[model samples]
Target: MKTDDAERPNMAVSIGRLMLKNPVITASGTFGYGEEFAPYLDLGRLGGMVLKGISEKPRPGNPPPRIAETPSGLLNAIGLENVGVDAFVTEKAPFLETLDTTVIANIFGESADEYARVAGKLTDVKCVDALEVNISCPNVNRGGMDFGADPEQAAEVTRAVKEATDLPVIVKLTPNVTDITAVARRVEAAGADALSLINTIRGMSVDVYTARPRLANVTGGLSGPAIRPVAVLMVWETVQAVSIPVIGMGGIMNARDALEFLIAGARAVEVGTANFVNPAAVLDIIDGIERHLGDAGVDDINDIIGTLDCRRK
Candidate 1:
């Protein structure tokens, strides 16, 4: 594959230890192992790609009626459906290693020991650029709530993952908490190299005509344009509370939304629900950002990261 000259010129943009050509990344569970969209867009042009969440064992995931469309967003309870980490290594990782972009493996577990074991295994996989600890999945009954709703538990999970691997770890935060910033601070103290927020907000809807809930899971994570403002606000608050870099996502649709996250203190932004509406959204966002930066007279993209207009505490 011939590398695009535009993407090769600036390769020093840092996303954790690995430098990327830019700061635009694809959110996990949306991009799907970095190969599905490769035919439509150049994977090398992206800053990085976050693979779907991986577990110790395969997950069949929720049954049908897992997706419910809202006015301007989507409610999903896909239940982290994936082929498991071990299978991913043999089947997906080999192909991913050939790609030019950075690879971030999103991992999840039901307990700290499970997290440690998974991270330990990923450490041996050279294709993985980083490990994104998905501690905010609300679809499951056990460890999902245990780590996400409590700051102390969140920290323990992060600490365990960090101890199990040398790779940079990114803890994805949930917005369902009363004070999302508190959880971020605790995770940072626990040795998270970076943070990503806000995961979809919890929500549910009823089918008045059918007399049942719209989704099989009863409740699902809310994501899309409706949640953009909330995500921006939470990302800004988290940036204020922690010193580690943040990767923000939630209802990000265009360049403006992505820039809002960058200014709000996210070192990078992820495109999640937006991809379902437009498979080309990632490419469009990358172009839109170049135009936005040029219009702002900003030569360096990193200058806009964490540049919120407020009194720094």
Candidate 2:
């Protein structure tokens, strides 16, 4: 028998002023505008959905052989292919505005100016509740990983996006840097409403038999179960570094994976690659979280956030 609503856990959480009915949000690139997975999930039931990375102009993405499956994870060099911001406004906005869930646009650019331009375009879109600035994209002006790997450039991009829109800003940080907290603290100082991290770990694989790279780009972002521990550690570190809420994501494949992040101090979590393996994985995560909370006599999910005990354990 299903428990009454009053008896179940309260799953709501807030990222700045953006209130999510629950803490499970589908990661940017993997969710693909939210419409693609409609057949598999009741999109409205999710706390939020982040559309694929979008730019000022439509992108053709990276070359073929862009995806490779490892024993514990997936690697991809998909170069932010999307239908551009204008198309999103004219084509997808109508359908998106009708959904009940929070809609977050994941915007990226080659430069700080470009990031501002893309953000400016989505600012007026009624359906977009917030802007998730993806700093992981290459900085064509400097080089790949320039903005994300450097503290100053990351802060500049965050400020640019913040000035471009009135919507709340969530800056997504990359994990390739030696000091992630340096970048996170800088972005927070630049006025980012919230933070999400760590973007896929930098990785690659060689086709031993063919004597070639597995991906067309020779390297790609690593995601899935392999990076969960790293992600949790980063989230824990960043949370202590900044006063803003942290949205955790990396290898969250199930309830426990998501729980690790929450207990480590993430206000919420985003599910990535797992969507490719199971379309309804996010929904299952939501149910599982509620079940775990219920079993432990937790009435409010917020009670579990930042509850990590590091006292000589």
Candidate 3:
């Protein structure tokens, strides 16, 4: 994490039509509904909190031993254990609405129609600031990777979800593909208002004592410091491939890591997995960005975004 003289922070970030005080947000499915962590941190200080992925129906998630700890990261097969959209609107949404920060609902579905139906329901919920369509879920059955791996399928799902709601649509993409840029272009054309990239890279681990796989689902998405480099490259490439704004996440632990995503061309960055390790990690990242800017003599933060000096050879 380098804090050079040229470093700074973006004054404001617009994801579709919603304006953020800064670009730092908590990744979906990890922040619960935003109320659990309210005791330790100020929810208003964050640009927004993407609530855990809510499905059209309640999901119990997977069996026990769902999470396994790794060196710099952990593997989890929680299977999107959520209280469903209606529960979120009735309970979670109301609580989040009272917060000064924005609330972005992360919606997931098993099929294109499911995506549309859920988006339609979320439209009536005024408290929701935007809709983040989770097309890539490694823990779910029949819904996770099927829609994300193919450009047409991804676009179709995005189009259906977009047509179902007036809320700004942000389609999250999977890293399990060969060319993520191609899918980004397709989803953007299909009516995605913005995009969030590099969802946890799909991965797995084994338990030596049990002589079996660690995660009950056999595999899970990997997040933490280890994925930072790949996330930066994906954000950079996706930014070059599409015209829509990009929200980047993957292995972001602090302010310096957050700055790398911006320099790589992400309009905003989402903090994931790190929350489980350090409850104050998000605030640390935000404060660090501000401190980095002040020390570098840069007042406005937007100036540092996408300022990399790479040249094609």
Question: What would the TM-score be for candidate 3 when compared with the true structure?
Answer: 0.95
Which pairs of residues clash in candidate 3, taking residues 3 or more apart in a chain or in different chains? 9-301, 9-302, 10-301, 10-302, 29-52, 224-251
The estimated TM-scores of all candidates read 0.94, 0.97, 0.95
Per-residue alpha-carbon lDDT of model 1 for 1-313, expressed as tens digits? Answer: 3246554323236756866667888999999998888788888888888999999999899987999998898998999898988999999999898989888999999999998898999999989989999999888777775697899999999999999999999999999999998999999999999998888899998999988999999999899999999999999888889888889998999888898998888888888887777877888898888777666777678877877877777
In Å, residue 207's CA in model 1 sits off its true spot by 0.7
lDDT of 1: 0.87
Q: What lDDT does candidate 2 reach at residue 127?
A: 95
- Between 1 and 2, whose TM-score is larger? 2
lDDT of 2 by residue, 51-71 (tens): 998888898887798889987
lDDT of 3 at 103: 83
Error of 2 at 240 (Å): 0.7
Regions more than 4 Å wrong, model 3 = 1-10
Q: What's model 1's TM-score? A: 0.94
Q: Estimate the lDDT of model 2.
A: 0.90
Instruction: Find the candidate with the highest TM-score and give its number.
Output: 2
